[model samples]
Target chain A: MQLSPSLSALVEALRCLPGIGPKSAQRIAFHLLERDRSGGTQLGQSLLNAMDKIGHCESCRTFSETPVCDICSNIKRQDTGLLCVVESPSDVLAIEQTGQYQGLYFVLMGHLSPLDGIGPNEIGMDVLERTLANGNINEVILATNPTVEGEATAHFIGEMCHQHNVTASRIAHGMPVGGELELVDGMTLMHAFSGRKAI
Target chain B: MQLSPSLSALVEALRCLPGIGPKSAQRIAFHLLERDRSGGTQLGQSLLNAMDKIGHCESCRTFSETPVCDICSNIKRQDTGLLCVVESPSDVLAIEQTGQYQGLYFVLMGHLSPLDGIGPNEIGMDVLERTLANGNINEVILATNPTVEGEATAHFIGEMCHQHNVTASRIAHGMPVGGELELVDGMTLMHAFSGRKAI
Candidate 1:
């Protein structure tokens, strides 16, 4: 049976969200109708509130309630003369999961893609350069993903950091720990061998 | 990585939606933050709007924006003196896809499960009886799936309908189309044999 207009509109609207196809959208729409008004309200209010209240931190480009993020404002964190650059806030999360680094972050929010007309200026590379010029950071870790586009973006940023006299290093790209050698690709094998450390 | 309070709350709120497992919730939550705020806002708002505005049709117990759903309201439908009863709206969708049936629907929303505290009253069987007291319907098809609980529910509802002087019939359960007889369970084979048509 066809859903009512309101329910149909709701289902269509839900289809806009990532990974929610038409069927899933209809299921969610009907489920909302069947139950969970409070949850639905919370989600709606949160979306509007987040959109209206949250903005990028001036320094880190990470989401913040204020002009500066909590991490940027914290005085306890080491001013370790080291900065790690990444493309998205999710990347910051991935790095934070390791808990191995104590350093500042710079989020690009997007990668540099020349064919798609995305450039250094579009992705806030100029702001990054200015941040580097103003800060006392002597080392920068280019922790962008090892994909072709990510690598190109990292290389461009590393060159800019070099011009500013900062020691920049690209993050390693190799087979995951515990991965079988047979499963590892050739390019990864090459990098693993070339970057191997003597015990 | 740990999300901030706002982000974490958004993700937690999303968990209330059906079919959204923890992993899918996490992915969707991050995806919303990463891309398409307009789409996310629209989705969240629609969810709230649907939950706030939509309700059950008094007649069919199906979701509707009005007192009676479109299917129940339509005068064009051959009040064919037949009622196809189902456990859920999804079942209605499945039946509607066949395009062979042109009868009215009565959604029970769930089956009778005594162990789980679900009984005829819980599934609106009492309300169904009251509705059927009008004697508008001739045949009541018990289209519940052929699970143990479904069979029990069908039997109970069938008896109730029979008492009301309405003819009731349980839907056939057998090896599905494209299904192998060898792979069919013994209970299903038994059901198939019992429900077999006389050639």
Candidate 2:
């Protein structure tokens, strides 16, 4: 199984992506070489293109070609006066798929985990404060994930928003759609019960 | 929730690699931004570097930076006289992992699938024949996989080797080690029984 340095290098490069283990990387590299040469070529080109052309949007920390992302540049979206906060651009897409939430967004780019050495500043909390200080937003949504670090980050952001005199609220947490009562996890069940409101 | 054109392009680009579905692609893209900026930068660089540097080896059809592959360049390997013919370079690696074979290789790069327009020439059978016709080799082991197309390609190669007056033989077909008798498929069990030797 002595592969050349270049072949091994490509496999290693692919392994840098999340969830692509060694075996899978080898399989993929081999499959790409054998089956879809054009696709493999396109993938390599696209990777370079994205890295060279894309940068963080100054306003929301989202990936973009310009200084500001498309959402921040659009005049129609500017009037929403509401901003949703998320951990990543992918989460933005997931929420958008629901066809709800017509407001703008702020991407944290990461969650806070002190043990892992991730801090508030590392995730651009200062930029968020600056956005809130602009005084145009009517409300700020603390949409960080429900994990412990995510909750801690949400609380920290809420406190910061209070200093700027902006109302801050956490997104609702409860059972997922199509989730069964018997199979629901304890924390989710508790959240669902606690958050229940009269019809 | 709306992503910019560049962000969308990055996501789509990532999905081109095998086993990388849309969700995983987005996760990888975001994780790059959040966890390891340098690693992401390196990945982007490597993609371009590999694309610009790597191509198919003229001799074995494996990905190589040179006209002939490193394996083909090894003087020690050239003398082994045994030639293992496989469906792909990956198969060569798989057999090499066994640490038993000391031989050269001829990679078909794919099977003979006429429906898909892949024929003998497309899979580099001419290269294999010319390499064999040099008369330095005595044995050609048909190490193609056990699939239908693999079998047909192996048979076809066997016929070609016979026409060139070279010793041609198929690799062993048998039950895998640690395999249960009950779990073994009928075809495999029959082959194992038929191929059994005297004690």
Candidate 3:
């Protein structure tokens, strides 16, 4: 179907969002044009504002409007010697939601995907290594996801930390706190059994 | 967790889109900030451009860059005497996609909802009446959906057409093409049976 030029452009632009297909893009375009023009305008302005203002934190590489993010700057979060290394800013938020971690964070923004040409430098591993070598951090927590790439990235980071003589630990791999044993997958079961501790 | 001001604003702005909840909004915001900043900027510019350029067609109320839409101004679609009244601009697109209708369209953008205080004038019903009474139209197709409100709006328009001495007809309702009888809803089956034709 031949949409108006502006509408077609809007649909094409909307496809840039993750998981939004052509049909969804069309629906969103019509929705913006038909019911909420002002809201669409506001969204556009907000997108511009975020794009212009937000950048990676200098200390941790997480998204921030400032060079150093809120967590990195706050004196109250005093665990500067303990750094949790994560794959992305979203992972930082997830960990923050737990309220258990008092340390600072290092956001890689991605894992080491050799097939996709994403290596150590691609995910800010060089920056992480520099931070570790500079030496305020006493321990590093490998909180990358449990996927194969995540595992490889964690192992690489662990090796780097070892070379720097810093303690490095991986987050536990086991059944989730609320997960039922029957529904747990075999790999998780194996990990849970192998990593079990005596109460 | 407190996100940066611009990031928070972006997340909130993303919520304005239909079906985007807070979680999805946050994910999209992070995706734009972390992975696709250039794409986000392009999307922002596109949104602004679409909002600035697209407006309702003065004649048909469908979205258009011009005052009158392409369909309304096209010389080849000469069946100006046959008007198809629809509930929304999306409905206009659906009908146009069928390629069966050569007539002009009258978009209501909404059906008559007394409870919502949306009456005849609210959805441009007065304009429809004016068009019908001007003696240019001979037939009005009531293609408002099959919902109760759609039915009510169609009935009201049908009455207005009768008052203006123009023929009014409702689109057919029945079992959908290729629909299985057992899986069809009772209401649709009833409609199919009652509206059955001779083989």
The residue-by-residue lDDT of candidate 2 on A29-106, one tens digit each, is 777666666676666666666667778889999777899877788777778888888988777778779978778889
Pick by TM-score: 1 or 3, better one? 3
Considering the two chains of model 2, state its CAPRI-style docking category: medium
DockQ of every candidate structure: 0.59, 0.56, 0.81
- Any idea what lDDT model 3 has? 0.90
Give the per-residue lDDT digits (tens) of candidate 3, residues A52-146.
Answer: 99888898999888888889887766456899999998999999898888988999989999999998998998788888888888999999999
Task: Using lDDT as the measure, name the better of candidate 2 and candidate 3.
Answer: 3
Q: How far is candidate 2 from the true structure (C-alpha RMSD, Å)?
A: 2.4
Over A1-199, each residue of candidate 1 has an lDDT whose tens digit, in order, gives: 6777778878888876677888888787667655667877787777766656667889889876778877777664436877898988878877888998778888988888999999999889878889889757789899888889899999999899989999999888777899999989999999999989889
Residue-wise C-alpha lDDT for candidate 1, range B1-199, written one tens digit per residue: 4566677777777787787877667677667776777777777677667777888888888887899887877765537878888988888888988988888889988888888898777898877897678888889999987778888888888898978999998787877889889999998888788888889
* CA displacement after TM-score superposition, residue B109 of candidate 1 (Å): 1.0
DockQ of 3: 0.81
| Model 2 misplaced regions, further than 4 Å | none
The lDDT values for all models are 0.81, 0.82, 0.90
The 10 consecutive residues of candidate 1 chain B with the worst lDDT sum are B1-10
As for candidate 3, its clashing pairs are none
Candidate 2 lDDT, B168-194, residue by residue in tens: 999889899999999999999999999
